[model samples]
Target: MWISLVYLCLYWAFFLLLGLLLVVFLAYCAYVKYIHMKYDHIPGPPRDSFILGHSSFVVKASDNYKVMHDLFLRWAEEYGPVYRTNFLHHVLLTCTSPDSIKEYLMSPTCPKDPYAYNRLFYLFGKRFLGKGLLTNPDHNQWYKQRRIMDPAFSHKYLMEMIGVFNERAEQLMEQLAEKADGKQQVSLHAAINRVTLDVITKVAFGLELGLVEGNKTAFPNAISLVLKGMIDYMKNPFMEYMPKHWSFIRQVQESADLLRKTGRKCIMQRKQAMLNGEELPKDILTKILQCAEQENGLDDEIMLDNFITFFIAGQETTANQLSFTVMELTRQPEITRRLRAELDEVIGFKRDISFDDIANLTYMTQVLKESLRIYPPAPGTSRYIKDDDVIEGIRIPGGVSVNLNTYIMGRMDKFFPDPFKFDPERFHPSAPKPYYCYFPFALGPRSCLGQVFSQLEAKVVLGKLLQRFEFELVPGQSYEIMDTGTLRPRDGVVCTLRPRETASQ
Candidate 1:
């Protein structure tokens, strides 16, 4: 019995690898025939290996996804603005030119590449995200959804959401005050995560976990498991397919299922309370749910996907942006003081900072914009070409994924006058460049669903914090960003905060 079991296991392992070998051979043959021979005009890297293509180069780069961006930059330098690279024999073409981005992102022909972006399904799950607007490849559905949902960002609804924004910002200030009461090295890594997560819950679900009260969370383990599952599936297999029944895939599906179940319960509970004639709080979450209910009540899967997407999108990106902005401001006191002076002018201590006050925060918004430019949370955006296309006179064959790297784009001297300098003044309304040239949230129809939400949260959070706190970088500490699930600081951001006492006058 033992010998038979061992033999069975060995046979399965042999067959699994053999099957992979066969798939690579077929894909390679098709590549050589259709891509290399037929579309020889495309510029790409020299073949690295039989199966991996440039996969090793990608994995070996210090910043995992940034590798492709770096390579694209080098090739663009050599081959021109548009270039292609073979990622695990799956061809990928990249673009960085502002003109190129405008042409493609706005064009009807270029669709999001599912093969390149299918890795996202692990986080949002197959069922919930199967056809949701963000991940869906179907242009018609995206157009329809965008039409229906885009109005949520209209000025009136966005203004209605500001009260929750201010409330969350106020709560964050109180928490920051408590943390700085000790004046020790406080890990902003922890603080920002708590604030953003709380903001997402309150704004996206009409639920408040009140996370900062304690370190414990009911969903932390499950969320971590989901993210881990995403990395495992996307990395280990690469473009080489993995079995659908793989353990990590199963875990990701299960965790998304759990988050969805809880989210649905919360949504239903809110609806039931409304049925009981209870007044739901006025906020983005309430508005979103009301919109969902009014759209004849979408399928629960889509509802859950949007909720999870909002939580992740609405949470991590804003938090990281704030954290990095704080990190930069603390290090540069000159810039911070300029920022504070501007803030004082725009937001007087005569009363609490109101929505109207936030509008006049021109420099603060510039500071936030520069930070996002420096360390964009989602550094790269991707698309798949379904038909052969030419850009800059280079033929890009179909079935290729293209990653446009905003991080590298920010670094390019062409994009900004002094690329590496953190000059918020560059964002002054009088700045030389056009608005379409800079896209922290992508421009055009398929841009970030929560652009307004993100901007409001950042402005409110940073404005409130700066109003109350004098932040300075602690000496002997250097902050470098790491490419985590989001672009996060490699080490914790440590800053000393002294309360800005307003009553002395």
Candidate 2:
């Protein structure tokens, strides 16, 4: 009789536990359904499955991220300017309309999504760009840092750096001259990347990384490997915990450590020099140290974060922009001819390009603008919404991601008619400037601080290249855009070059 009572009690307990689980599962399903129905009014591609959502389709389309941006273009065509795509529980709203973009980006109500920016703060179990101006989500903190750094990027300061720009750009011309024999194919992208890296290191930290002089450094390859890991991490969300990827992960972490250690060493040496009562040049490093001393609660690690941040941001985007511009110029000889005509009128065999000359080369300026429109180095920006809002008659609930993509909008027919055509005239100073439809440097307060700095470097480099060499794109290479954190020509813009006089004949 005792055994029978025990078995009966156990049976009742099992059923009660099972019943509780069923109730919980039902409640979860109801919540998910509510969320789905809330976004149903916003148009998007059909969800493949409840679990994977549209990510499976996007993942299938991606090839080294060559097709990912294109997929966004296609979807934008199918579902107006605004649409929502989901990856499991994460829903991202893509806004392409000018008004929508202006409201989402320019407004103070929406803040940067920590999901995307925070990922840049750490990679492969190591910290990078920790609370730097670019990745810092706190508006107040970022504004403080920005105010301190503004003087460094002012017109007066940048004008003083033109000599450094000319010196570094000339180094590139020397390297390319060796391969300008008309038969040897050159990867302009790789060559330009080295020169730009050298420029940023010298101009910012006052360190001479002689990458352009053929002095090999592990820093370049190390930075590249770290960036490559971004794509890998995104592809396999479970990579950090997976044992198979441990080796690669370690390599990336080591590279990040090398960067931080190098930054720390350089910073300490400079600080010591200052303590010794030695006069120092008013370069970026000097400015950073001065800011550190003056600001309260700012730590050394945060200063180092800005160190790496400037190195990467100052170099990568500008290099990619120059590469894509070269690729387009090769295909559009008519445009190239027009640019050359302007270069001759303004530069006229002048090897040293001055700031005043850069401003005078109006046609060259337009070409750069058009290239950026087609292949924006940083393709898009995202924001996290905190309060429910209405945009273009659609209700956007709080706690969702909204992406503003320049690449998608730049290619759209609505904003830019015959968008694929390589026409520099569209950017002529007399022509109407693109409204909110164009924001390559982004919009409002959070826009890139290095905008003028990068563009000046680009114009200087390209003006010299056009003056010295006539480049032709090597056939049988893919012109596809590769998104390895930044968009670059897939084949690195392979081209055979001949001295300008010979090709002109």
Candidate 3:
């Protein structure tokens, strides 16, 4: 009788466990149902698959989806400026309306999306841009660093760097001169990339990378590898774990380490020099070191973060912008002629383009603005909503990622008529200002600190090229965009240059 009771008790225990599991499963189903119903009222494209959702459609765009900006552009047209898309369980709402953009980006309550920025925090199990001004999602921490770094990018300081800018831009012209005979096709993007790379290294840390003169440097190649790794990680975050990608992942990690190690060495040298009472040049590094000393060892990692930050930001974005500008100029001869006329009147074959000259080249300024509108280098920014919000009468649920894509917004016919046409008049001084619709360098307090600095460098480089040489696009070269971290000309702006007859005369 006792043995029979034991068996009965065991049977009851098993049934009770089964009943508990059923309750848990039903509860989970109800929660998921609630989530679907919450966003069901919102308009969006149907999920392309149950597993990948609309992200499958986006990733499937493959080559054309280079930067993913094209995907956003297509969806914006289909679902209007504001629509929701999903990547797995995460809901991403893209907004192109000026008012909506201003509200979310400018609000203190909204922070940079942790999910998006966290990807940049590490690259293949290595510290990449940890707590840098760009990737730091913590608003208070970012604000503090921004305050400390502000003086380095001040108007007076940037004006002082014009000599260095001209020096580097002139070196690029010398290199281009060899290829300007019109027979050899030149990759303007490659050449400009070197110059901008050299310029940032020299002006920021007072180190001459000598990349413009065609000297091979580890830093340049390392940066390239890191960028490639960034694109790969963005496409597949689990790439590092895959057997096929191990080699590439290892290379990226080594490159990131090389960058940080080099930065640490430079910081040590600079610190030692300060202790030795050596007179230091007033460069960005000098200013950063000063701020670091004040923090009393607290800002060591922060210092390294900014070091990488300035190098990448100061070079790649500006080079790509200049490359896109050249592509546009080659396509539009009438605009080039007008731009050349303005360059002649203001610069007049001057070897050294000054800060004041940048202001005087009004038409060139407009041309640059228009180029950015059509081909934004960085493309977009994102914010994480902490609370449910209403945007254009559509309710955006809390915890969803909101993307403000300048590339998509810039291409919209509602914001810019004949949007694909490269027109400088849209940015003419007398023309209406593009309130929140056009933000190549982004908008508000968190906007690029290097905006003015970059424009100054671009004007110097492009103006000198305009004054020295006339370039034509090589036939049969594709003008596709390549989104490797930043968008660049896929064919690297292949061109054959001939010295302008007017300049020769």
Residue-level lDDT for 392 in candidate 1: 72
Tell me each candidate's TM-score: 0.85, 0.93, 0.92
**Over the stretch 229-333, how does candidate 1's per-residue lDDT look in tens digits?**
555456564422455546666666677787778888977887788779889876654665677666666666666666667766777777778888888887677
lDDT of 3 by residue, 212-317 (tens): 8878888878888888888778878987779999988888999999989988888889889999999998888888778756755437777888788788888999
Per-residue lDDT of 147 in model 1: 57
The CA lDDT of each predicted structure is 0.70, 0.85, 0.85
| Candidate number with the higher TM-score (1 or 2) | 2
Candidate 1 lDDT at 78 equals: 76
**Alpha-carbon shift of residue 326 in model 2 (angstroms):** 0.5
What candidate 3 gets wrong by more than 4 Å, as runs, is 1-34, 294-298, 502-505
